[model samples]
Target: MYGIDVITLVSYDQVQHTDEGMLSLSYWTIVGAYTVRGEKNDTGTMVDAVLYDIPSRKMLFRAPGTSRIKGSSTLVNLSEQLRTDSLNGFHLAADNLVTNLQLELDRFRKKVKAMPESYAIEHQPGYTGGGSLEARYALTLLVIGGFALWSSRRKEGFRDKF
Candidate 1:
């Protein structure tokens, strides 16, 4: 919405390690010759992500997060456990990526504003002309008037709740 031409790039990938074997277990109970099968898992997952400002060619952020998941021995399904763990890891990593991107965007705007005009001397995205704030406000007022006229008769209250 601002005057600047903003370009954004994002990418992500997932990595899984099934060779690690069961990561960590919840609990185990043993008495004599009997033992309870606790939650078990054999795979670890992580998410790697990156985002940048294409126009400025500045590296915005990079994030990686590990998924914490446990499979139950009672379930007797290693594949299911791996799937659940991977999904959790992805979700966690996505959160990190989004948060970092937002922060970097704010930083980018401030950094651009503080720099001198010479900083953008070459290699710029195409121009994007737009009407000023006054024009936009006038258009908004026009639409509001049209809506008020169309919504209710002279004697009726406004259609809007407030």
Candidate 2:
């Protein structure tokens, strides 16, 4: 059976402060975890992910599409569709996050613009999370690896075919 998982956007950061700069964002998502059993290959699981920018509503990164169909060579239609559906769910979540962040930023800017110069409206150029892009990538890899291992172990002998 085909299933879609809804991923929530947990954390967000506005990386730049120029009038034309974009908002950098990070969040956790779980594309439907899958467990498949078939001839030859017993079981497997996969997780898909995507990263996006809030202000620009742009997709910054996406994990390579993956499916772990170990046995039978032929993929069951439901599993195939699950992959597409999961990706679509992620896209929708990213869009919603952008909309929410944009609305909040716009409101904040309006409030600041209405204030007098005495109330200095200072824009910080950078607000880092202590983790740079490279660090973030490494962290993501760690998370993916952890999950793959966890899922594999959750179901005995479910060799990771990712």
Q: What is candidate 1's lDDT per residue for 25-84, written digit by digit as tens?
A: 322323311233344454445555555545677664555545454444332444666677
Q: Model 2 over residues 64-101: C-alpha lDDT tens digits?
A: 22223322211233455445444554555456555655
RMSD of 1: 10.5
Q: Which stretches of candidate 2 lie over 4 Å from their true place?
A: 1-75, 115-162
Q: Report the error of model 1 at residue 156, Å.
A: 35
| Consecutive 10-residue window with the lowest summed lDDT within model 2 | 18-27
lDDT (C-alpha) at residue 151 in model 2: 85
**Which regions of candidate 1 are displaced past 4 Å?**
1-8, 18-75, 118-162
lDDT against the true structure, per candidate, is 0.55, 0.42
In candidate 2, residue 6 scores what lDDT?
23
Alpha-carbon deviation at 58 in model 2, angstroms: 27
